[model samples]
Target: MHKSIAIIYNQPAASPYRDRNEQSAEDGVLVEVAAVEKALHFLGYLTSKIPLALPLEQAFSELSLITADIVFNLFEGFSGFPETEALIVEQLEALKLRYTGSPAAALKLALDKAETKTVLKQEGILTPAFQLLDNATLSDFKLNFPCIVKPNAEDASHSLNVKSVVYDYDALKDMVSEISGMYGKKALVEEYIDGREFNMTIMGNNILTTLPISEICFSLPQDT
Candidate 1:
């Protein structure tokens, strides 16, 4: 029997903020959807593409009409509302549908950088010293100089730029304020390690397999 799969993904749209870049930074999702659909077709599985949009109810209504053995969840939430990413997974769970990638709870936890780091610290994992700050809070400078400030609950390097790294309390405060004002969310200030950055992706459950490590090389000025 051929299994049916639904490729659920969010179509890129323009943001309301005029100051923000209007060009769809996430246009790559279209390519990803095409690639996944093609691969699934080659694998002999029936596939359907579902493009999600705002007001979620419309997407859910469309999903109700589809019957698939599994949903290849690619929804990364609307452009600005990153918090809704986990809600998509939760909806799938509520409908008793199996989907790929992290579950709703894990997605929610991971989205909150400070909470995720706290859990890691409790588990004795080595992590940089960090603090969560909102618009009204002042920086205590708990972390060392050359710290990085980022949105607490956003991914894909949202609201991040060269100025995100600060070398002093004043710079940290300005960066934190800028991030909070821009993203309208709490900022996570953490110690910045000025060295090589590596990322490792682990796949599978029970029997785990690690993918090749990837490194990021910066070409811009270090103090930018």
Candidate 2:
């Protein structure tokens, strides 16, 4: 059976690197979409490519088009919305269409760093001390200084940068305000780990395996 696939990626407004020309304009997301499209075309999948400014509806109802088979989930975000990842999956499930990548709950859990940390902490895992914010109170309790501030509900380093490190109360307050205003979400401030850095990647549930652990290499005059 032939299938229609939608290769979606992060949109501009939701991207923190929207203005970052580290490589080129357009944030290079189109490059990703194009790569995936080309790869599938190389394969034997009768795929139809589509750009998503909306959710799963993007796969259908565009110039009178609708997909009847599998939908290769490539959507990173929709219409500059940061939390739209799971939303797309949900729409797919509602349509009873098979796609790829993490399920909706995983997307929700991974996107919410605070919840993920709590689950980890409850499981006796180590995590940095953190705080959540809202319109009312934001860190009334003591939070470790020289901390890192990240959006409570955003990813892709939205407003996160090396400058996200703040050492004083006023700086923290300003950062929180800016983040809340810009992303319609709270900020999480956690103690900065000054010693070392590392990363771990896990693929497939109930079938866990570590390929190669990543390490941070501190160069002279960089870590200091």
Candidate 3:
């Protein structure tokens, strides 16, 4: 007997981007979904592709109707509404369905960068000193010059661009206000750490396995 898989992913919509020329990260998920579905089919598993959209109740109803043994869990939530990503996972839990990827708790924690930083600090991990600005008021700004500002709750580099890095207080204030006005979220200001960045992908639950590490080589300016 073959195992059935439900490849659930977000149906992307037009969203605001700091760089208009940059492709929509939300829409990019479709390409990933297609690849995963193809691989599953090639491996002889019965796969069903379900694209979810806005209105959480409708998405939940659609999920509730799934009969697959497991879900691929590619849903990243609707554009301009990143909070729905974890909410969808919570619904999956309520349905008592096994799904791939991180749990709702982890998703919620990761979405809030400030909270994640706090957790890291508690765990004795060394992270850069940072502050969250809910508005344009920048009294007692302590972060050094050449700091970077970004939307507090966004992922996929939504409001991040070349201009995200600031070298002065005026530019920092402007950037913070830009994030608040455009994304309607608090701004996170952190001291700029100029150095190499790498990403490590880990898999599994009880016994984790780390994949090959990849380094991000920057060809852009230092402040970018």
Task: Name the candidate that leads on lDDT.
Answer: 3
Q: Tens digits of per-residue lDDT for model 2 on 15-117? A: 3445543223335567777788788878766666656664445533441343636666666765445567787777677667667678888899988999999
Please list the residue runs of candidate 1 whose C-alpha ends up more than 4 Å from where it truly belongs after superposition: 16-19, 22-24, 220-224
| Candidate 3, 142-195: lDDT as tens digits | 877889999889888777788999999889888988887777777899988889
**Can you rank all candidates by lDDT, best first?**
3, 1, 2
lDDT by residue (117-198, candidate 1, tens digit) is: 9999999999999888865776455667788998898777666778888898778888888888877777898988878888
For candidate 3, give the lDDT: 0.87
Screening candidate 2 with a backbone cut-off below 3 angstroms (N, C-alpha, C), the clashing residue pairs are none
Query: How displaced is residue 159 in candidate 3, in Å?
Result: 1.0
Structural RMSD, model 2: 4.4
Pitting candidate 1 against candidate 2, the one with the higher TM-score is 1
